[model samples]
Target: MTNTPSNAAREESLDLASIPPLESIPPQLGSPGGSLPAPTVDAGWNTRTKALEVLAILALAYTLFFARAVLLPFTLAVVLALLFRPVVRYLRKRWRVPEYAGAAGALVGTIAMLIVALSLLALPAEDFVRGLPEKLDAASVKLNQEKLFKSFVSMQKKLNGAGDLGVSTETPAPPRREGEDDEEPEGDDPDYAALGAAGPGAAAEVRQAGGVEVEEEDEPATMVVEERPPSLLNRVFSSAPEALGGFALAFVFLYFLLAEGDAILNNTIALLPTMAEKREAVGLTRAAEKGVSRYLMLVSAINAALGVCIGIAMWLVGLPNPVLWGVMAGMLNFIPYVGAFIGAGVVFLVAYLEPDFGLLDAAMAPLCYMCINLLEGNFLTPAVLGKSISLNPLMVLLSLAFWGWIWGPTGAVLAVPLLSMTKIVCDDVESLRPLALLLGPRIEKDDSASDSPDAESEKPAATAAPAVAPAA
Candidate 1:
């Protein structure tokens, strides 16, 4: 057979004589004839490295999800105990109140207050619930009558264009008129009587006006259920037993934490084996517990004051269900931004529903929210929480979202203390020192905005205050 050297000779340097043998390559290539390119420390563009990190993070999250779901209620209780424990301690140490007695008293007081608040919510809620069906009918009619519903009309048009879902596009013929149905009983039906009682001309007019004719058996399928309780109430009552169990668990846990808080902390720390480290850990735990308790107590007072202020404002505006709106604002104020928006939404909805008020009242809802929230954010919280526990807005929002995801509304409400305790723990842990910075607030220094006069002063003329020679 003839060896095919012709194609190899035609290609670029495609010849065995032109290629260096592996053993003849340079030292870098494990030979004498060639060298390898310098290797780079690729820190950024490593796909394998990134994939590993992503997988690890996902695995950790999945593991945490199960752990959190199981222990979320306990975690919630731990945060609350931290918040309320100091009060129990103070009562015990100063007033000589028994720990168990203090816990019982606090628990009863809290529950009684919550029940009274919820009881007050019953009436307005019922009224709102009853009026919903009517409002829905009015709103539906409004879609046909008003230009404001043009947007919905467009949406409906789009929906229709997406192929029929059962509703016929062609105009449906009128149902078999009364008396046309031979199966109908020869008895009085108010609908048939009302439709048939009219004179021939009036009947024609009614038909033209779309009243049409009705069969004796044609009763409305749409039921107006006025007696039904609000879904929120129904849900609450349905879940009451399970909720009570959780509440009872939390209450019991809180009592134990209060009764043996210091002992527990000391014992845990004592197991550390080193006196200095144990002392430090014990001090840190006490500080965190005390701070959390103080914050909760102060927030309660502030929120109550805010609730009263909001209630009075609503009453002045003649808004129905003023108490609900007030309580809503007060309760939500605990969750940073989340509460403020909820309060605003309630006010807006109330104003929208009240026949006496219109768009103007609805607009005032946001303004009212802004004014109250401005006072709370700029004046109230800053003045109250002070520099000691001041979390920046970004950190607060993230904490709220994180804890809310971990638990629920209760988590959102308890986020601050949870995050605060976490921060305290992070501060104590040398390895997690950087994490404390990430979790905490940003410290912005405004040189020009300082309270000092010299910092505020503009640069003087070049002739004045020439640079002084240092130690001439």
Candidate 2:
């Protein structure tokens, strides 16, 4: 190798030069003198950080609760905007309509249609309202006659220590002493005739008892002692202003959202730094919008169909107010799980209150309603919605509970849509993919975990391990 510029010599020299000196090489982690491990803050700091995150979440919840008056309408508007997006688009594309014009027409037409429908239903609804008390009283009487109701009442009475079901529970008058003069209280019942004669005059002093006279002044007979219960008209008028205000605010928000939603979305997407981020933002927004709108529209249609089927069934069974029940079923179906049961219960109660219905016959309407619900929920919904908008049943219930607690019935109605939106967002974001998986109907096992660094590192070692042959 002397004085020879050989390939091996050159290569060896290169290798030697490439190898870093021991002093220059960093110490390995976990070694005694490893480069002072990245300085970690106190564990207390981490605990404090976690506590701050929890407090942030709690504050968010508080804000949502307190701000519901405004937020509820805005949320409703958002959902409605998504739902109406297609209609507005159609109008714009087909007739060259302005976004504002299209939105206005759609919103106005819907309101008008609602007003007309309400007008049509008003007579029957009014009649129903008027007779509701009578019907309820009759139903109560019938219920009391039932063995089960009677048993429940008796059990309740027993629990309250009120003696037998049929026996009077009132306290008996105290037994009079044999020598007692029962009729000696002459001044106890003062003459009201004298009081009426001297209306609003000086206080009247009755006969003295133990040398002390009791004087009583009279109030005007015309003055009311107790207020009459509020009438239906009064109640309706009282609520009208608030209800109307809410509707106005909601519609105003909806109109703007419908008109400017696309522009807002575009602007939002444009603000993202990278092309990827912009694309991701657009995709996420579009997917969320589409998913929510499609789910709501399809569910609405299904509910309408369910309502129709139920109404037809009711009519066939000769039940009163089939249309009302149908509309109620359709409306209530917006609320998942609970809505169906509520509609069914109402139908059952109404059916049972009918004189012609035996207990079995009364059950028919609710059974029919439930059958329709089962078909729609289990078969139709799954098939139509598929997995895109599908959510975990447990998650849905949790959302319902949470949102309901936050905003009451309106929140319950909105829970599924809000959850769907959340799932869409989670699905789009890489970090939140796990949460999306959790929210989805099926939790898929992550096969990608096997592709982790440790596993990958072990793969080569296992492959490179020298094979040992068995010695015979």
Candidate 3:
């Protein structure tokens, strides 16, 4: 026992020596005695990094805005390529046409149809233009005859006169002859020498007849012809060469896109780091293309039907330029909510301006437009597009506003398709699924109650309860 105690004392001394004093011991990270070096706070570096990221994003936006001249055509080409890709593919597969030839044929066919439609409407458009002045005059005269319009105009004039709106109503006094009273000149001022020279014999006869001039019949006043500025359509046509060049470039881009679509797609996929990433990218792209193309096709058909219905309705109502309104409707319908309203406004204005149409008759055009839009928006689009292209109305409006702000009317026309494409991509990306969900319309769940705690409690009790034995 004494030897054991001596040995234990020696071991304790060794342990104490090995352990060292607490002050001498090196502190470990995250230990009770030490912190993790205060996390090496490089706040300045973090701030700089965040600032750089923000700057990069701003630069990218700036580049997109300024380079839009080049980007717009390419972007339009991509969209068109996607749209006509199936057509080109069909021609190649079915008829064994060369890819390039098939793409060219499909593009040319589309262009020809557009040109034919425009040509058919050209005469009517011209007539509408030619008759615009007469129509305006008639509308003005009718408005002036209306008591409400007259009262409104008089009130507006009075308001203008009362307010300091820079309008002057007082006439300046007529100039007075020097050294004479400001009295009217006596008995019909003598004709000027230049005018008398035109008919010297009449002037001589008047002088011979004791200065009593036989009044020559008043000459007809010359009509002053004022030139009007060219119309918006005319101005657009005047720049057709530039527009056509851009269109040609877009078509060329589209042709190559369709011709080499597989190669391009494969090359893009090859750039991904892994097979899974590549597959995901491919799936996302195909989904976007399919969704956008299907939406465009269905919307186009629906708009075409709407145009026909509008034309027939206008014809029955005896509205002028029915075809023009029809074409306008179809073209503008591509712009979604805003476009429909604008088209309806155009119809209403035209109907109201018709010389022969009364107020009730004028109202028919807009009424018809509303009914058609209602049917299409409520029933037809939902039935055809279903839930695949469904987007939150708020998101749709915001997208429309954003794109329209960026690219004007063209962007507005392309907004829905672009939004649909974006949603498809976001849905395919795991990280971006939240964005996809935000874009989707809200769906009320019937099973929401079944997912509650009360439902779970009842479910367990119902399942666990034993059945009582039936009477023998």
Candidate 4:
């Protein structure tokens, strides 16, 4: 029995030796009884590298935040260039215009349109500014009368009392001398007297205490007026030269990009090592351009139409500055969900504050706006954009918040387009396809996977192969 066992062991050892080494064997043949070797994992180094990459990304984001002044205008220009590129190309090809001339013409035409739009809005804007103070005062008074404000005030008073904060709520009555009539205070009406004397170069000697100014001189005095520092808007307008310089730089960049279009593309593609990579890069670039440009153009057209409808509706409803409201609505609509709300809020406020419109009439403004937004969001956008460029609602909101934080309003405006482009690029690149899938909306599995006859037939072969492995 011992000899027999030894003989069996010797035969098994010979059989094992006859087989090739796992490394030397063809992978397909070796897989019959053995699993493929697991790939080596470097837990420490990989974690370190991942951390460094994250740090680098954070550092880049920091740099972008600080550099936004230069970057914002450039980004705007790129978007504009993309928008106008097709027109420029058409002018060059159809009209036989030189590239430089076509670029200049496109740029000038855009500027002229902007100037015309601004000119149309100037009077309305001026009127709005002139009446703003009164409107604000009225709004403040109205707000104070609201139950919410009253409750807030009461809560604050209770808190103050509990803390013994020494807050006062007293109003002292004016002293009345014997035989002095309350009606004999004509000169004490500062506003009436001030209005009567109000004109250019009119001045009064005033003593200011606790934000209240008391006029000492009733007569019109030569006012040595002290110039107040410029406001935020004023400061921005005052830096027009810097703005213009940035615009000029952007225009220059746009011109070159439009002019040397093929050369730029060729140079970019040439940087890649393999022909396949170059082709892929070119394809991705074209796809991104097509998708982004088409989206922008379609959205612009839709917004323009919405603006016209808003203008007509406001006009029919007897709203003041209908054109102004329309333009604002159209412009703000570019910002997605937030934009529509902002535009509606402005309309609601204006309507509510208007002296001519009653509460019912004022309510119509928001109602109309809401209806328009409903139609646009539910019907128009989906029908127009279709499935190709559709993005997840959560992704859209997140992109909006991210870009809004990074680049402010401009960033918010560009967020969807940029996100769409990023998704497209990710979808095209093999390694990034997973990210693209993640960004995309969820898709339900098809019945074909389970119902296919081929799949059913293959199940037995698949199970048999595994079962046969152990026996082999």
Candidate 5:
């Protein structure tokens, strides 16, 4: 059959009509026919939204900083409650004791122990502080006697002499009278000219013959004005009232938290809309509580052991005030990385200051401290903490820096527990699991998963080749 131009035109019109409308087509397919999609406003993130998020974070930081007076005590209270919660629960379950009574007993016992420790260490610490100035002076004299110290002093003096060259300290010879003799009297033999032009470290030779005493340039007059700031003792005494108030507030909060923790948890969980959400919330809370409490308890025990070892080592090494050093070590050990170094440095200083200590004796104390610290940090801590509570070292450092900036020494002490809690929360939530993994210690990939039934089933689909169209 021969096709007419009218029939051909009709067929083309029908084919065009079969094509879908532009509005009906997906945006990804461009304008009806397949073409590159037009640029549209990004639905994921915009400048305004990101800016608001940044502002929100900054606002939060500002609030935390300014509100620390109230917040610090509350935070401490929460931590204490977490630490003692298991004990309270145990007492209630085993002995039929009320949570309130158990918490009170724990608090009282802890305070009493602290008071007893302070009482025992107070006299030694006071004596050490009182003798510190004399000890430091003795140490300084010893250091000055060393050849290295003398060399350094010599270098410094030479530098000073060089700096003073070309600068005249004496009064000029009355502008030299116009007709006066330029030369001095023969008897006097004045060598002022020689002294002035002789460069650095030159003394006047004429002074001895003339019986005129010349002050030695090497012996520069030093007026020592010791400006001592308030001591640690004075600072503590000054802040005693505030410290007491904070402690009282913390104890009160701690008591309430302990007494009502379960009720609070249950109420919060009950408010969730769905069973899955409630379960997630419950699991997150439980995990956080267990992890934080366990970490604190274990750390306290480890610190105590470290303190005991340090005390024994100090005693064996004949260091005075072993108990004081031990107590300080334990307290300082609460802060990570920096704390151990500080403790060791302080020990070295104290040991070096002692009159009986030789260089080797002085070195021994800090060496021992650092050795124990290394052992505890590298081996004992990791073993006890395990993978679940362990955090990435970088994240730990960042947390320490952030918290320390926010709340000083106390914040530094709390940094690890806070970081652990954050990691636990992230790990529990599906959306935050990736972040949790980032914060967590590195894990090896599981090759066994590839051999599993489900993975094997997925393999064919994942690796399958695409079907090719036959050539037209």
Candidate 6:
């Protein structure tokens, strides 16, 4: 027992020596006295990179805003080149056709079609646009002459008591005493007319009170807020020269870009050093070209479907200029969300122009939109596009808005292609690969199905031609 006490005292002294002081010990990361070393952090690169990125983005945004006037067509040309690159490649590789020949075919094809279309439609469109003022004037006149305006006048007539505006206008509403039922007869009603005119007693009491201005609140709230579309006839006529010049330049630029696409891509890529990087870049370029081309083809098919359906729908609806409107709708649909509204506006206006159907057909505008959009979104888009251009919906819409804002309608048309190109480039770079994953179609691994017997079973059997022995 004496030895045990001595041993315990020794252990205690040893513990005290090892522990040193409580303040010296780190907070336990795992167990008491157990802790990890502070982790190494690389904040310098991230901070500098973020600052640089912000600066670059701001600079680019301003540049785009300022240069939008010139850059719009050029940007569109570049996107079109990307989209058509695969077709150029395919013709060269498969048919042994010259690249220039292929590009010329595509460029000519696109321009010829657009020119023909625009020519056919322009006169009617101009006629309609020129007449907008007259149409609106007629509408305003009809509105001013409507019974509703007369009703407002009649209601206002009540406030003046007797013949204030001259003639036997409607009598003023009699004031109701407290606890008087609204259902009571006029003879039994209080004299609110006397209250307004020279009066005493209850009329005098009414004179002591304030007069209320009762507005005729029967008009539709939306009609009250609606504004007329600005007349663009003068602006259209004034800007025609500049517009035509731009159109001419656009055609030339498109042809030049398409014809020189391969050369441009090669020259750019060839400038890179002869290393692994050059090879990787070549692959990425090829992939990006393929992606953009597929998107273009898919969009074209979708547009064709849109044109057909809209034409049929309009024709059935007995609307005038069905074919022209259909073509316009399909062409405009390229502008994303704005396209839908534009198409709807055209349909609504045409419907509203028909005297018998004006209001009735105008009411069908929303329904028409639903049908067309449904056909395009549900049936046409998925079946044709599938997982091809796997763009995030939010990103797609935002990109549409961004490009649209920067370059107007043309910019909106360029938005998706630009976004797809961005995604492709991001996916190619190792540092930005995570963003690619975020932007790319959500891909699923096929490890299980890849090895499954059913997958093999689905493969078609090879047909064997008659075989002769070599000895013969």
* TM-score of each model, paired residue for residue: 0.63, 0.70, 0.72, 0.67, 0.74, 0.63
Candidate 2, 334-437: lDDT as tens digits: 88898889989999988887777767888998999899888889998877766566688799889989999998877998898888888877876789988988
- Of candidate 1, the 10-residue stretch with the lowest lDDT total is 442-451
What is the C-alpha lDDT profile of model 6 across 312-411, one tens digit per residue?
A: 7877777766778778777777766667887887787776665546455665854675588777877778777775457787887888888878877767
Rate residue 461 of model 2 by lDDT.
82
- Candidate 1 segments exceeding 4 Å error: 1-64, 67-70, 135-147, 150-238, 427-431, 442-472
Error of 3 at 451 (Å): 9.4
TM-score-superior candidate, 1 or 2: 2
> How many clashing residue pairs appear in each of the predictions shown?
8, 0, 0, 0, 0, 0
Error of 6 at 219 (Å): 42
Which lDDT value does model 6 have at 126? Answer: 77
Q: What TM-score would candidate 6 get against the native? A: 0.63
lDDT of 1 by residue, 1-472 (tens): 2446765556755566578755343445464554664565777779888899999988876665666534666776687777677778779989999888888877788789878977889998888778877765664554465465677788889988887667757988888876565442223765446656554566567768986555779767997777866687688899789677777777777667767766787778878978888878777776666666777778878888888888778877777777877887888888888788878887876666665555665567667766877797789877877655556578888889877776678778888767777766666677876877787742334632464566446344333446543434
* Better model by TM-score: candidate 3 vs candidate 5: 5
Q: Write the per-residue lDDT of candidate 3 for residues 175-229, one digit (tens) a residue.
A: 8668865443333445335335546666666657776546799999999999999
Task: List runs of model 6 lying over 4 Å from the truth.
Answer: 1-49, 90-97, 141-230, 427-430, 444-472
User: Local distance difference test, per candidate?
Assistant: 0.72, 0.81, 0.79, 0.79, 0.83, 0.72
Best by TM-score: 5
lDDT of 4 by residue, 1-472 (tens): 7699999999999999998875555567676777766666877998999999999999988987889878877777777777887877789889999777888888888789988988989999899879988977876777677686899999999988898967679998988769765442245465436534643223232222233355887878687989899996798789878768877787777877777776888998899999998988888877767767787899899999889998888888777899999998888888888888988888888987776665567779988887898898889887887656557778888999988999877689888777877777776678987888777842223535656788799978998998899999
How displaced is residue 340 in candidate 5, in Å? Answer: 0.9
lDDT of 5: 0.83
**Candidate 2 residue spans exceeding 4 A from truth:** 1-40, 154-238, 442-472
